[model samples]
Target: MTIKKWFKSGSPWIWLNAGAIAISMIMVVGLLSLILVRGFSHFWPAPIVETTLTQPDGRQVQLLGELSRSQTLPAQVMREAGVDIPSDIDLVTRHLIKQGNRDVWGRDFVWYPETGMDEWRYPKEAMRLERREWGDFYGYPVRLKEEGRTVAEGEKLWPELQQRVDRANELFDEIRGIERGDIGAVNHRMERVRLEERRLDMDRRAGRIDRASMEEATVELEARRAELADEYAVLQQRLDQLYQDVRRDTLVGRVMDGREVEIPVGQIIRAVQPNDMSVVSKVGLYVAQFWDFLSGYPREANTEGGILPAIFGTVTMVFVMSIIVSPFGVLAAIYLREYARQGPLLRVIRISVYNLAGVPSIVFGVFGLGFFVYFVGGAVDQQFFPAALPSPTFGTPGLLWAALTLALLTLPVVIVATEEGLARIPSTIRHGSLALGATKAETLWKVVVPLATPAMMTGLILAIARAAGEVAPLMLVGVVKLAPTLPIDGHFPFIHLERKIMHLGFHIYDVGFQSPNVEAAQPLVYATAMTLVILIVMLNLTAISIRNRLREKYRSESD
Candidate 1:
């Protein structure tokens, strides 16, 4: 077939492969875009309750909450339900669940957000709250009643008032039943008093007034006193229970009474702004900065989204790795290309370099831990920086060690790329340069290296992209989840190379899973992840641009 005919026939397969690749790229781009947009959007201004509450100590605190009411959900709801709970404010939740009131369970603040109900993870015995300090710091908001007003009116009293009604009913039931037991006991005692009175009357009527009957009358009176004491004890118990129920706020009981009172659940009061422009400006800036950092590419902790540290670490490590590996790789490539005889030994060396590339990265991580960090770095630090001692100064995982390890790991790629670029140069060009009074070393430095730097840079860029995103190895070496201090700081020389640093890659893993507050940490996780992907793209783009420029510079020489 003719060349044009062959080109036309191959177009279908080319289009198919290109279309598949395009769709995949679109999908990847779309997912990353969504994560970036949503993660940043969370930091935008959200509605919050604004109030300045006065504490018992006469100090005002600015508090923020999602609910509208100052009278937050009352903790006394437990007591109102006749639940014999402990005094621990913390333990109050368990008994609250035990009461099984739909309003308390469904609408209470404690566990509503996490568990969607009042069910508590901790047992009542394990929970404890300081009693004396438990005022507004503890219960539903009960604003101080005015001089004239005693009962809080409307929805505010609904929950607590219902509690009182329940208390009254319980007390009424016990009081009404007093005749069944205590009243009977009282009656028995009263009978003894009557008998004593009758005996005394009978004796007097007989004109004898017997001493035995008078003594019996006194004994009968004592029996009546004992019966009356028992009835009083029973009545007192009922009154105490009534008093306990009355103290619980009315909101809980009222809510249970089928009242649609908007009981404050997660109520928090914050300071209200007095419409000042300066305050508005500060608020605006805070919101804008928050969104800006979250939306951008990954950086160091001290920068926007803290992606700068990642970028600096990644580029710095790669440059160091290339510096360490390039000379060694280029030397080995040169020996194979120009000096080495085509023997079995040379072929074996070539095969070994290729095999090294295929070794699992984790194996390198293990080797770095045992050989490079502990053995080499420990010896260096032991001899030099002893003040930062015992903590494995150079003997630990760090930028220097990561650079060296990756250099060894990616050496074969540099070797292969350099050798190929060398081979591509026509033998005639080398001969002509040497013929013009240039030695082999001079020709290499002046001619070959300049021509091949672009391809070598390509190999280095690939090595960098892989190293920057590495995590499993970094964790083993030195990427701590929480470093007490940043690796870079302002002290004398400024960059604290000895200090452990935060990495964007590690930050994503730590914040997403290991953080104390998962709800709050999730946005940060997505923001970091989005930032990292963007960074990798940027590094690769730089490498591509360099390659294009060199290809253009050298294209004319070949023709």
Candidate 2:
């Protein structure tokens, strides 16, 4: 076709649209690929290098670390930063090394100029200890001590140290179980008893109960307190024993500075001699570390450890939001589409709902904080949990408030989708149902709503995708840096809606912006961002699957 004829037929526009879509898809794929590469590689056991770094004063110092990153910068920038870069060089490449004995060096990473580093070595006996606190330790194993006595040294120490580390880990797990599981339960029960006693006192002062009944309730509460105390005592004894066992062995290691430091066995989460590891061993360790990252809790101001809590909180809050929003959103859509009169009033309401979708998310967060938390939650605390007054149960940022806030924020999306779905239903179907002796409500409820279910699910999918990645709204409503306990636990009201939760979106923000060690937390930021993307995709896929099934079922029925 001629150029003018092609333009008239809109052929160029078609090709242009296809090109734009292709470009968009490429960009998305590229972004995800970058996140996956940078995030997933963080778990790999990179070889630790022992090298000599020449300081600007011509003094050579031993350095031990894994290579973190490298960047090329202008020589002038280096000079401005007080680095002794040569004027002859226009550009200087600097390397960031993760010298992870943070407690010893007071820094987890250091930047060194490429020209100043030399004598690189990878020793098989060099050790990397992933600790429970103060970050990783890079050193050479010198000896193993039992209590205060030296039990193994030289070649005998490695195997003995491994065995002791395993034992210590086991004891640590047992101790954690006692502290968080058994002892936690006792503590919860004790708190409940205290609250009950307070409630009883309030009732007595209010004349809601007579003296005889008050005495009986007080006696029962006292008995419950005594039982919980006994349970706590036993758990405490077991916890003490486990702590002693875990602390019984120590590993003596020589750091890069050539100073011998003693690390208690309990403090070491994992010990690896990366240079000595075979390819198979390295791969195995990589998988294990990634799994731990997925299942463990954050440590070191959220720079180290796994983000299981954040994952759990994100999924749980989304689930709760779906529960809260689905029914209300569907009802509102139904009323607007099927019941409400079609007039200027309805048009204005529809316009308002559509406008709400464009409102800033942080605005919704502020509204939720004021209206939902301060007003509604404060009222709930006063009415339902007066015994815990001043302590504020629901009157704080928590899972329920976060879910409610998100549900409200995404309500417009759900209502619009559902209304569109309802509009698509053939009016003939409604007329036929009515002709078959069905009332208007019955025709709408059984037939129209069922056909619109798939669209409702579409709205839910959109809502979840948006809510899962929202950090600002969550921060104001519920999310915290670290929750000592998960919202869902073995405690009473197994789902603790009032407790604050950790979220993947908030985690990325905190690690990326709020962390004390920016270099150490950089990889974690990518990892957490990747996790949030995956979580949103997963939630959307699940909702999409349901919508597809519903569509298929309805199509078959119509056929």
Tens-digit lDDT track for model 2 on 1-559?
A: 6889989999899999999999999999999999999999998999999999887788988989899989999999999999887668899888898888888899889998886788689999999999999999999999888888999999898888888888888888888788788888888888899999999999999999999999999899999989888888888888888887888888899999899999998999899999999999999999999999999989989999999999999999999999999999999999999889999999999999999999999999999999989999999999999999999999999999999999999999999999999999999998999999999999988899999999999999999999998989888989999999999887667999999999999999999999998988999999988888888888898889999999999988977
lDDT of each: 0.56, 0.92
**Candidate 1, position 321, lDDT:** 69
lDDT tens per residue, model 1, 304-326: 23344454555555566668887
Q: Judge candidate 2 at residue 526 and give its lDDT.
A: 90
Among the numbered candidates, top TM-score falls to: 2
Query: In model 2, what lDDT does residue 114 have?
Result: 80
- Misplaced by over 4 Å in model 2 are 1-3
TM for candidate 1 is 0.53
Q: lDDT score of model 2?
A: 0.92
* TM-score per candidate: 0.53, 0.97
